[model samples]
Target: MSYELQAVIGAEAVLRKVAAQQPGAVVVPLRQGFALIPMTDELFDSATDGGRGDGLRFSKLPGGFERVLADWSTAGPLGYVEAGYAGGVGTQRAALWADGDLAIGPMFVDVNEPFPAIGSPISQVLAHLGATRRRRDPDEFVAVGLDRCRDTEAWLAVDRSVLPEVARSRR
Candidate 1:
């Protein structure tokens, strides 16, 4: 099946700060201490200067968004990752923010191409965020259980009972 995902992945603590700032943001816990906030149309419209579209230009994402991620780095690194696949071919982009700065990358990877020695863009961010690969796991994506869902919308189906809080304060 084809896969697609676009979201911000970070430690639950760090994402809580994001949720606080972007009302209606949901913090869906993953394996380990990490969690993800599915980037919705509303969030994109509110955060970007370029208006919503297919690509993410961090410069267009506004200084306020970066300021929140910067301020919460003590909790952990945060990354925005987008991936899309069809018929086994896909593209992925990822950027890591830690210690109030861009740490790893806003790197892009062609999933059907030979991956960099380090791994795919998302795996690099996941590795930086402390995800470890298990014997049967192909990469951090699967190791963190991201492979369980083909898209962010499906991932958002996570049981709310596990989340410490889900921001529903926005319209």
Candidate 2:
């Protein structure tokens, strides 16, 4: 099915870096806008192996601001959240964020099936998170976090951080 998810950043939380790491933080642009770094390796592995915690839809590599930004820009705002799974056999879970706020479900979908259109539940989720079909610059928007939902209740929280270069670049 190969489902894809997208979200829009908020206005309050312009992407910024956390002082805890070097290079401060990095923002990777996508076709629609910029994105925070991909889920951590531990998180990705855990999700893929079906160990602990929710699973992720995408995986990211280590790199610098320019490279990530360039990749995101070219790749468009949309990227793989998770792949290599089907019918609960392989990895099928993915997490997407708008800023620091979780967007939708650990959106479970068959990577082998066609993605849902904008009016479907998945599409609505992406829309609620701010995703748009029109192209946008990451610097023009803010970032939000992603959350897992079942029925109407949210049960999980995914933290997101922005890149420091965003500020310098903006200046």
Query: Which candidate tops lDDT?
Result: 1
Q: What overall lDDT, based on C-alpha atoms, would model 2 receive against the true structure?
A: 0.33
Those runs of model 1 whose alpha carbons end farther than 4 Å from true positions after fitting are 51-68, 71-75, 162-171
Can you write out model 2's per-residue Cα lDDT over 1-171, one digit (the tens) per residue?
A: 222222222221233332112232333332233343334444233223343322233333222222332333332322224334223344333333433334455555453554444333333443554665324322212222222211111111222244344344334
- Please give, for residues 1-171, the per-residue lDDT of candidate 1 as tens digits: 799888889877779776887755788777766788887656656665554323444322433555555566656779878888899898888888887776776788775676699899999999988888878889998877788678768876777575332332111
| Model 1 poorest ten-residue lDDT run | 162-171
* TM-score, predicted candidate 2 vs. hidden true structure: 0.34
TM-score on alpha carbons, each prediction = 0.80, 0.34
Q: Give all candidates' CA lDDT scores.
A: 0.73, 0.33
Global lDDT for candidate 1? Answer: 0.73
Q: Which residue runs of candidate 2 sit more than 4 Å off their true CA positions?
A: 1-25, 40-51, 54-80, 84-92, 95-103, 119-126, 135-171
Using TM-score as the measure, the top candidate is 1
